[model samples]
Target: MTSPEVDFTRRNPTARPLTDKERDALDEFVDSIHYSSRYNDDHYEYRHVQLPKQMLKKIPKEYFEPSRGTLKLLWEEEWRGLGITQSLGWEHYEVHEPEPHILLFKRPMNYQPPAQH
Candidate 1:
């Protein structure tokens, strides 16, 4: 299945830097989102990890998926929003949980942001 696209520019144009507390809140929110989404679904296991502030900055607030209870990291959001798919010669990105406190997101090898015109 394919993920949905989100217009980051329109969603969070000039998103301000989050404070330390907000960063923590984002982490907690991600956990809650994952848990709520997977609690009743046997196919998914709830898991979460702290991401660096730099990495998190690229993510749009709307990507948190509060309404649908899903987690959308920066790379996934970018991939979807840019309309680059595996069938379109775009490499797939992977979400990595290296440890309990670190979540790594690997961007597609050849992704280029859509030119703003």
Candidate 2:
């Protein structure tokens, strides 16, 4: 079966297209994570284990992984951390970090942004 495609535009309808460097960084960041994907008829689901802080150092600072408070808000609001996903073209379905050094992320294949006028 074919891998699910990332609908970049759907991540943020009003956002501009990603620059080559931005795309490269995002690809690198995504690749660094250990992840697994499962596909159901409706959508693809992904679970990504957190990368070490040192590994994330190369990524842009704006995309700081997630703070505990931020993770709480994301769970309470059913929203992803925009800072982390802003350039990645993805959003978190769930986030759990039992300890400071360990984190787990769940994300759906599609990211649907609000309609833009």
Candidate 3:
């Protein structure tokens, strides 16, 4: 809820168009590293993917029945099927869509390059 980026204020400055180089770089960057584990190698990348229906059916009964917040979290897990443990394991979840399901989980943070020397 409190991201520093939220503090930026362009207010009403004139909208200058993007530069050609910036535009090209932006295009290339966008085209490069992308979404979809199906497209890229799962090597070390950890993703939040939706678990397949077959796999999801095996979730614990308690997990299968989630509360509002927990259901939302389960929805994400089911949607993303989150990749975990170096592609070895995945967190299971369930969503009680009729009502709101609430659950708490500690997810791995997105990857960050190591600091340069």
Cα lDDT over the full model 2: 0.38
**lDDT digits (tens) for residues 14-54 of candidate 2:** 32333567555455445445444433334544444455454
Runs in model 3 deviating more than 4 A are 1-47, 68-83, 86-117
Question: Model 1, 3-114: lDDT tens per residue?
Answer: 3233343222332444556555455334222211111122222222344434444444564435433333334334334222222323222234333123322223344667
TM-score per prediction, in order, is 0.24, 0.32, 0.24
Which one is best on lDDT?
A: 2
TM-score of 3: 0.24
What value does the lDDT take at residue 83 in candidate 2?
A: 22
Model 2 segments more than 4 A misplaced: 1-32, 37-46, 65-90, 99-117
Regions of model 1 farther than 4 Å from truth: 1-98
- Model 2 TM-score relative to the real fold: 0.32
For all candidates in order, the CA lDDT equals 0.35, 0.38, 0.29
lDDT by residue (tens digit), candidate 3, 15-110 = 233345434433422322222242113332223333333333333333332432232233323323222122323222222343222122222344
Q: Which ten residues in a row have the lowest lDDT in candidate 2?
A: 73-82
**lDDT for residue 116 in candidate 2, whole number 0-100:** 72
Error of 2 at 112 (Å): 13
Better of 2 and 3 by TM-score: 2
